[model samples]
Target: MVKKCFFFFSFLFSLTFGQRVIFGDDMSNLPGSWTLGGTPGNYWTQKSNRWFSHSHSVKCTPYDNYNNSVDVWMMRSVNISGYNLGVLTFWVWQKTEGNDFCQCQYSTDGGTNWVTLWQRAGDYSSWQAITLTNLPNNANRIRFRFYSDGSGNDEGVYIDDVILYGVNRTTTRIFLENGNYFPEGWTLGGNYNWTKVTYRYKSSPNSVKCSPINGYGYYNNQDNWIDRYFSLTNYDYGLLQFWIYYDTQNPQDSLLIQYRSGGNWFTFATFSGYANWTNYSYNIPNTADGLRFRFISDGTTTYDGVYLDDITFDGVSTPWIDLTTLSIDSPPGLVEFNDTVSVSATVANFSPYVIGTPVYYRIGNFYNALRIVDPVQPYTTVSVNFPDWIVTQPPGTYLKRCSTAYYRDSIPNNNSLTGTVTVVGNFDVGTIQIISPTGTIDSGQTVNPSAKVKNFGEGTVDFNVKLTIGSYSNTQPVSQLAPNEERVINFDPWTAQSRGNITVKCSTQLTNDINPGNDKMEGSVFVRVLDVGTIAIISPTGTIDSGIIIPKAKVKNFGNTNVDFNAKFTIGSYSDVQPVTQLAPNEERIVNFSPWVGSRGNYTAQCSTELSGDMNSGNDKASGGFSVRVRDCGIVSFVIPYDNMPVGEYNPRVRFTNFGTEIANFTARIRIGDYVGNATINNL
Candidate 1:
C-alpha cells in the first residue's frame, strides 16, 4: 500500500484545457459531505467489502484490524472556487505496516493547516490509480490520512473512485430523441422498470428497455435506474455518445455507467456479456451534473436485458492540431557506406491550436522537405533538419520516415513516424586478433608474427597486413586506418624451419574491400627441435604423513639450443638423479631429488627427462599418486544405491575420504541384495 518515490508530472493542462469531472465519489453510500476525523474508533467506513467501481469502497480501519495508535481522517469540502488548475483522481487499496501512512492531504483553511498531497508506506497489493497534479489554486480541502505508530497493523486504506477536476470554458450540446419517450429531463429510478421498446433501436422506432420484457426479470434482484439532468454550469469539455444493446448475466449481471460529479456518484462504465448495437463514448466532467443508467441483478442468472439508444451530448470546442512524429534524431543509428547523414526529425505539437506544418523527411528512397517556419505552440516540440543523407544503401535495414502536412489535421492517426537505419560497409578492413606466434615455437626459432588490424569502414585506410606461415609469407604496411582504428601488424622475422602443427594466417589487404567477411584470421603454432620435458611432479602430491620425502621435477627447455638436463625421481621402489643446469631456450627448472624415507605405502610417483637430443620423445614422462597415511578413512565414491533396481524407498549415499595423519573415526556399510545400511564417521 505504501512505497513512495514518485515524480512524473506531465500535465500540459491535459493538453490545454478540456477535462471536467468537478468532484466525485463512488463509495456508494456514506457521503453527507464526508467528515469522519482522527481515530475516533478508527474512522472512515462504507465498505461493501472492497470495490473500485460499483459495489462500494471507502474503508480505513473499517471494521477491525487497523489499530495501534491510529490517526484516521477522511474529510472532503471541495468547491474548486473558480478553477485555476485542478486534477485529483483516485483509486487506492493499501495495507500498511512499517512506517504506516496513507496521507493525501490538502486544505487551505476551512479545516486548518494540511498540505501533503500523496504519501505512501508499504504494501500496495493491486488497485493503484492516484493522479493528483499541481493543485493548490487555493486548496479547497481534501483528505485521506491514516497514520499508525504503536508498532504494527495492516489492512488500512482503500479509497476508491474519487475524482475532482475543474477548468471550464463553455461549449454545450445535448440530445436524446428516441421518439421522445421519457425525455423531458429524463428520470426513472430503481425499479421503475424502463420500457419503450420496439424490438430494439439505435436510432429509429424507439429504444430504451431494461425490463418490461421477458428475460430481464427472470432472476429479479434488479435495481434498475436511468437518469439525465445536465446543466454543466459553464461547461469545460464533454462528450457522451451512446448506442447499446445487451444480454445480461455475464459478469454477474451488469450495466452501470454513471457520472454525477460534485454531489458524488462516479462509476464510469461497465457492461455485460453480449453486445450488438455497440457504440459508446464518455468523458463528461465539466462539473457534470448527471447521466446514469444502472441495471444490476444478482440473485441468479438472466439475459437479454439492456438496449439503450442514440443519445448524444457533445460540447467539445474543436480546435485540434496534433502532428506528432517524435523521433529520428539524426544521422546516428549507424551509417558509413558513402556516409553523409544529417537527417533529423522530432516533430510533436500534440494539438490544442497553433500549428503551421510542412515536415516530410524520408530516407531510403530519399525524399526531403522541411519548413516548419516557427508557430507550433500548444504542447510544442520541434527539431526538423532533413537534407544531408547520402548513404548509398547496400548493407541492410533502412526505413526512417517522418511526416506531417497539417491541413485539416486533427490527429490523422498521428501523422507519420517510422524509424530504423544501419547501413555499414564503405571499405571495411579486418583481421583483429592473432598477436605473436602463439604457443610453443622452437625449431631454430626467430618469430615476430603479430596481427590485430581493424578500420571497419568509413574512409581513411591504407592497409597491407599479411602473415601466412608454413610457407612463410610476411608483408606488413598499414598506414592510416582511422574509423574505429586498431592496427598492430608486425611481421618480418619468420625463421622457424618447419616442424609440426602450423596454420597461422592473419590477412587484410584492403583495396575495394566491401565486407569480405571480416578479412581473415586463423591461429596455431607448435614447432619443435631438441625438446626436454618432464613438466610436473612437484612434491609428492595428495596424501603423505610419514617422514622426509624430497622428490620434485618440473623441467622444461623445449630446446632451440642452450640445454642440459637429467631430472628423474621415481618412488615406490625408490630411485633419484637430478642435474638440470644451463636450461635456457624456453627454460623452466625445479629438479631436486635425494632424500627419501617413507612408510605406510600407496606410492607411484615417476618423473623423468633425460634429454640427449630428445627431439620430442613423447614429452619425456611424468606420473603421480601418493599415500602414506598414519590412520586413514575410506569410501571415496558411490552416490545412492546404483545397480538399476528401481524399487523405491532409498536414502543411502557415499563419497567419503580422510587419507590421514591422526584423528579418524568411522563406520560405513552398504549392501543391496539383502538390504543393509549403516553410516557413522567422524574426526579424521
Candidate 2:
C-alpha cells in the first residue's frame, strides 16, 4: 500500500495592524486594500472627488442639487474616432423618496468646457451605471457629476467602487449587430483620404473640446472631411445624411458634400449653425465617376474646427417600373419585311426587395407567368413577340435595350434599376404598308374598300369575330376592322378638310398598310358630287335567296334638270350588286323578291331599271333600298376537341352547333375563310 496522506491545513487568525498583515474573521484589521476613493476603509458620501482608480473605473461621488441644478465636472482632453476609447462610468445609490439623477460629463479643455453624453434621473433606489460610452476616439480626461434635486427627505446616496474601463485598448471591444450595420456614421462618402473625409457619429451635446483624434477633439477641430468614390456605369441616384456636433466656439461652420467630375467639384449640401449632433438629408443623380465631400469651418476667422464624423451613401428607387415597359438592351435589333427574327428581353418585378428573395421568369404571353418573376431564382428572362415581316440581323451581336424595374427600398435608401442592357437578337426588316389611298365614294355616303395588306405576298388576313364592326352594331367610332370583316365607313364631307380625294386612312395599327389589311389601312376615296340615293343605306346588302326577291325603293328628286333612270342593283356581302338606272316619272319602285344569292337579313341587288316612256328626267330620280342586312347563313359554330386546332381539310372531327334559329343548307357552299374555323355543311 502506497503511503498517500494529503497534508492540508486551514488557518484562521485575527490581529492588529502594524508590521504584520492582519488575518481575522471579524474583518476589522484584516484588510488588503478595498478603496472607496484614495482610502481603503468603509467610507461613502455624495461629493466631488477622485481622478482615476486602480480598479480602473470612471465612477465618482454624487452630490446634492436643486431640481433645476446640474453637477459641474472638470476633466482633460478627447479625440475623434478612429475607434471608441475607454470610460469609467459614474454611479450613485439613492434612497429615492422620488426620482434620483446622475450625469456623466467630460471637459476636454480643462474646467473651462464640458459636454454631457448621457444622464439619468428616474427612480434611483438601486445603483446604476451612468455610462460614458460615447468617449471620443482620443478622449484623454473625463469626469462624472451627480445630482439629487433634494426632492424627498434628502435620504442622500451611497457610493463605493469606481471602475475604469478601457485601461487597455488592445482587448476592449463594443458589441454591434452581427449582420446589420449602424445604418449611418459607418459608410464613408466621397474620398476619405486624410485631407477630406466623412465619418459618421453617434450623437453629441452642444459644446465640447478635444486634442485631435478623440470624439471631443474631432468635435472641436472641425477642419477636415470624409468621402468615398464609385463608378456610374449608367443612371443612378445617391442620397446622404449626417450627424454633426455644433458648438458655440464654432459659431458659423458649414457641412458640405460634393460631386467631383470633369475637373470641377459640385457641392451637394451645406449644413450650418450651432447645435448638438442631428441629421440632414440630400439627393443627387451620380452620372459621373468621382464625388467629394467636406466639413469645413466657414466662420470669419479660424472658427473652432468642425468635428465631422460618419457619412452615408445610398440609392433612390422608381416604383413605377412595370415589366411591360422593359425594352431590349443595347443596340436594339432591327428588322425589315418578310424575314425571320428572334429577340430576348428582361422582365422587371416592380416590387419591394427582400434579402435573398427570388426573381421570376416568363416565356410567351401566357398569363400564368406573372405569378413568379422567374421560374429559376438566378435568371429571369423573357422573349419578344416576333411580327411577320422580319429581315436581316448582323452577326454575333445583341440588341440594345432598357430595363424597367423599381429598386427595393431599404433602411438607408431605395433605388430603381434603370440600367442599360444588351440582348441576343435575330434582326430583320419589319413589315410596312403603303400609305396612299384605298377607294372612292360620293360625299355623305358609305363605302367598303379593300385595303391591300400582305406579309408573305399570299398569306390571307386572319381576324377575330369580336374585332369586327358588325359585332358592335357600327356604334363604334371610325376604327380599323379585322380581316375579311365589312366596314361601313361614312364619308362625312361636312367634316372633310380637303376637297379632291378624301382619304379615310385605316387605323395605323392595322397589320397591313399598302394592302389595307392590317396595322396600315391606306387607300384614297374619290370625293364625288353628292347623289340622291347616296344617302340611302343598302337594304339586304348581301346575296339574296333566289326564292324571296321582293325589293322596295325610295324616291328623292332634287335636281331641276331632267334625266332617265336605268340601273340594276344586286345584293350580297361580296356578291355582285347592280343599280337600276331607268324608271317611271316620280314613281318609287318597290322590289319584292330575293336575289339568286339571297340569305336571311338584308343585301344589295342589281336593280335592273326599265324606265317607262312617260318618266320625267332629273339629276335625282327614283333610287333605292340598297341598304340590306342578310339574316343568317345558319350562323354555325363547330367545336373541335381543341379550340386551337391547326388549319387543314381533314374534317377536324367536329360537332356543328348553330347559334341562329334556322335550318342550314349543305348545298350552300361551306365557306372556309378568315378566322372562322372550317365548318361541316349541314343538310337543311
Candidate 3:
C-alpha cells in the first residue's frame, strides 16, 4: 500500500522576473514550490523511461534505452486567465503491448484525474518528438498519461527525446512596484480607478496603440500617456497611434487630442466619449515633425482617465487610412418637399484609403448590406438621394452614412474591416429633394420654397411637404406632396411671424444617418417675427431597455406679427405632435421630454410645416448608447482517473480540460505547483 502525503502552494510566487519556465519534470524535493506531481508510472516519471531528454534530438536519446514499460513525458502548472495558451511535446515509443501512444490530461480542482492528450502508435519509437500544438491557455495541472494499448512491445519497441515550446502572452497590468510620474500643468487621471488614463506599447513614434486596452468597469486609472513633445525624429518610427477608451457617461469627457503648438500645448481634435477603438486614427504632421502627444482628461470631476495601447507611427505616416465618421450628415438646413437639398462630404489625401478610385464612397445602412461608390459626379463629394430612400422606406428615419477601414495586410492598409449600421424606427418617408433658391432672397423678402419629398422611410401614411421659418421651430404641414413624387409650396411675402431670426425647414418624415452625430437638415431663410418661432419636438430624443427617457422640446410665440419658420425632430412612430402658438413679443416655453421603449438602433419624430406669415423654424434630435458584448469565464470540462487519483511518491498524474472555444496545443504536462508524485503532459 502506497501511503502518500501531499501539500500544495495556494499562493503564486511573487517573482518579479522577466520570463517563467514550465518544464514539468516529476522531480519531488524540498524548496521547490512548483512541481506538483502524483502517482507513479504517470507521465512525469515517463521522463526517466529512457525517452525524455533536455534537448530535442533523437540521436542517442536518453529515453530510447529505457527498460521500463513507460516512455518519455513532462508537464507544468499553468493558471488559466483570459485566452491563455502554450505549445509542448514529448518522446514516443512502443509500449509493452506493442502499442505506440501517450495522452495529456489537466485538473482544475486541486489535481486528481488523468485525461487523454494525443495518442501516437505504430513505430512510435522511430519518431523523434510527437508535438501537441494548441494547448488550452487556462488554470489547471496538465499531465502526460501514456498507454500501451497492446502496442508497447520490447521486440521492436524503442523510445527517445521529449521536447516542448510555448507562446508567452502579455497583458496590460500595473506592476504597482514600477510607476512613472507627471509634472504640474499635466495631471494623473482616475485617482486610482486604473481604468482611465492611457498605456503606451513602445513610445517615441507617437502612434496610437494597436492592441486593445484592458478595462473592467466604468472608470480607468491606467493613464498611459505620451509626453507633450516626443520630438518625432526622422529615425524609423515604429509605433503610430494608440488604442484608447473612455466612459461616455460623462459628457465633458472627450478624446481631447493635444499637440505641441505655438510653444505651448493645444487641442487638435476633440472626439466625444461615445467613441470606440474601432475605425479611429490620429497622427502628427511631418511639418510639426518634432512634437509629442498625450490624452487630455477634460478636467471633469466625474470622469475616467483614458487608456491607450498599440501605437504604430513611421515615415510620413501612411497617406491612406480608415475613414469612419460619426455616421451622420446634414446639408439642407431644413428639407422641404419640392426643395432640392444636397449633403456634401469632403475627402482628402491625408489618408491612404482615398488613394483607390478617385476618392469613391460606399453608401448603405448598418446591415452589412453596402452599396459601393456610386458617385453622382466624382472626386470629392458623395451625394445620396435623401427623399428617395425615405418615401421608399416603410415609416422610420432612414439615416445614411459611409466609412472605410484599410485592408489588414497591405502596406497602405490590409486586414479585416468591420462596421455597424442601423435601419431604425418604423416610419418611412420616401425619396427627399430640396430645391435651393434659384435667385437669392434678401433678409425679409418673400421666398417660394418647394421640395420633391419621398417616403425614403419604411412606413406608409400621409406624407406632407413641411416648411419652417425660424432658427428652431416646428414646420407647418403644406398640402401638396406625394410618395415618390414632387410638389412645390408658395409662401406669402416675408413668411410667418416669430421673434428673433428665422430659418427655413423642410423635413419629410425621418432622417437616419449611418452616424448619429449629424442627422438633422434645414433650408436657408431669415425673418423677424414679433415672438419666438412656434416649435415642438413632439417626440422623445432617445430610447432603450434599462435607463431614463430622453427629453422633448417645444417653442412658441408669446408675441405676434407675421414670421417665417422651419423645424425638424426625432420621435417615435406615433406621428402626432402638439403645435406651438399664442404669446406676444416676450414669452418662452420649454418642451417636456417623454421617452419610450423600443428595439436597438436609430429613431425620430417630427411635426413640421409651412405658413405664409414670416415662417419660424426649429430642429432637435436625441441620441445615446448601450453595449453589445459580454465577456465569459472559461470552464474545466473533463478530467480522468476519477477523484483521489492514486500514485507513487514520484509519479505524475495526466489531466486534460477543454478551453471551450478554440483548441489549445502542448507537448508537456500541465499541473498545479503542489504534488507528491511526478507528472507529464504528452501527446494523447
Residue-pair clashes per candidate: 7, 166, 263
**Which residues of candidate 1, in runs, are more than 4 Å off?**
1-238, 241-312, 315-359, 364-397, 400-428, 441-451, 456-484, 487-518, 521-523, 527-574, 578-684
Q: Where's the lowest-lDDT run of ten residues in candidate 1?
A: 1-10
How do the residues 1-684 of candidate 3 rate in per-residue lDDT, one tens digit apiece?
010110111112221111112343212221133342333433233133332322222211133333344444444466633333444544455533334344555555545543344544454444354555344455366655443433234422333322222333322211111112222123333333222123422222222321123323333322333342334444222123344444443545444556664566656655545434422234354344332333333333434334344422333212223333222343322343333334333332233222221111222321111122322221243432222222222222334333332121123332122232233343344324456432234344445555545433233334434445553333434333333344444433343333334455566544342222222345553334433543554334433333344445555553344333333333455332444444334454554434544444455455343333433334222233332122222324325434576763434435455432224444444454563333443332
For this target, which candidate reaches the highest lDDT against the unseen true structure? Answer: 1
Residue clash pairs of candidate 1: 1-123, 1-124, 2-121, 2-122, 20-285, 21-285, 663-684
Candidates ranked by lDDT: 1, 3, 2
Q: How close is candidate 2 to the true structure, as a TM-score?
A: 0.22
What's the C-alpha lDDT at position 26 in model 3? 18
State each model's C-alpha RMSD to the native: 27.1, 36.0, 48.6
Worst 10 residues of 3 by lDDT: 1-10
- The alpha-carbon deviation from the true structure for residue 618 of candidate 3, after best TM-score superposition, in angstroms, is 49
lDDT of 2 by residue, 271-356 (tens): 45566554343445557445454655432544333444334344432222223334433223433333444434444333331111
